[model samples]
Target: MDDFRLFTSIRYDPELLKVPSLGFTNVGWNSKSSPFHMLDFHRDRMLRAAIYWDWTAAIASISGQEGLENLERFLQGATKDLVNGPHRLMITLARDGSLGYEISSLPATHLNNLYPEYLPNQSFDSDSNISVTVRGGKVPIKDPMYDIFVDSQRTTKSEFTHYKTTFRDMYNDARNRAKVNPGDKKEVLLLNEDGYIMEGSISTPYFWRNGKWVTPPVPRKFDAFQGSGGNDGTTRRWALERHLAAEETVLADSLVDGEECWISNGLRGFICGKVKLH
Candidate 1:
């Protein structure tokens, strides 16, 4: 697991420049066999149960030596929480050996928080997560960790719990398929549906042209294309200071061009600088 074990610097107090070698964990690949169709997720909750163990292990690892007692308490209870509560990976900012507050999930709906950017020497490829700036040295934070996008249904479908299906897996799976450029030591990106210009895979894409940024025109009539009130082009809403994108009739041909390409998925938003295709 050397590939899993990373050596890096962490910043607890920037003034002090305290960079500890922390361990961040990602879940193993979700069983892709479970297609996120309308009928599949509810039919099979047990199959997705493995993610619980993965989370527990990661929680323990994050609290290296000086761990967070309160957060650690929460992780200890996760096993019990899994059987009775909702299933999702947790993100913690570990310091010393203790963990930080907590970020529940990294679904496409909230990618802007990461503030992803593109670097020239940095790059991404398929099946390879072009090393983004993560903290710690254990698993590479696997799929579904922070790449899920949820859609709520209040007075809608009889089965509104479908978020347990559609987003959790699909969001991360797309990043799993991306490629990386070996030459750039700092090059990293996520590869979802958003094209090269797109920064996020599950969320959006970014392209640099004339020092300007552009995202993809969302697919119209998409499976999850609900209105703004409900679940619409979630990828378009990643950082929406102003909502410029919408569910329109766009084709694959429209993705190319743009100086540098990026994908903005759950864990990483506007991930510019990809070296591979979907």
Candidate 2:
């Protein structure tokens, strides 16, 4: 299956998850170049994971500016035919540094509309120079508000959990233990043995505490039994850089029922979510 390949799901969109601090101009539909969200961060993350796993070939494949450009070109060519999209780009890397990808159309989520503060100025020319035939299909429906739950089981933190790769058995197991249905608009949060919240099955988890947003802290290094951390997600990194959220140890038992909070990932930005403790 595709899960055997090391991968990352990137949101290739004309608009979505765009912030002014990223220092990009003519983003979204106005982009004359490839419109990949947080491309640098994603590249760096994969490199770091490859280094950790000692995947030398993978490291060399995505090492620097040249690598970034190569990746951008690949994405552009892959989506050149799409007339309109906010598609999810599933990029996979093999041990030999060979690349594989799959593109799927995505519906507009409430991300940009609900979090306008994170959006870039949209006063650019309306006549976008990008020319691609729009695929014929019914307009995709907006994603529903997600139902977030805390898993009863504790997960052991390791390199797999720290990196965004295809080895997602830990996450998949957590979801299964919680009996999460495939079509359910739900995310199950994982906790470590120390009782600190790690992250969600497929997204980073955040909480509102003391009037501030706090996510679980991820340690730089951890021994087999010592490090109980979460993935350093792209959205999580962006939030930390902008001070939109802070890193603090969040105990799993501290979460309250029906509390409002947020969750984020590369494909989906900060999503308005509600806690459902069981």
Identify the leading candidate in terms of TM-score.
Answer: 2
TM-score for each model: 0.29, 0.79
Cα displacement (angstroms), candidate 2, residue 75, comes to: 1.2
Model 2 misplaced regions, further than 4 Å: 1-4, 16-33, 110-144, 220-227
Tens-place lDDT per residue, model 1, 1-278, is: 11121111111111111112121112111112111111121112211221322434434443333333343344445333322211233323222222332213222321112222222221223333434453222212122222221111112211111122222233344334333122221222322232212223233444444434444333222233332111212334433433322233222344343224434433332333333323
TM-score of decoy 1: 0.29
Top candidate when judged by lDDT against the true structure: 2
Tens-digit per-residue lDDT, 102-190, candidate 2:
99887665434222233111121122221111232111112355788888889888877887777888889899988887657788999
- Candidate 1 overall lDDT versus native: 0.27
CA lDDT, every model vs. true structure = 0.27, 0.69
Error of 1 at 66 (Å): 31
- Looking at model 2, the pairs that clash are 14-28
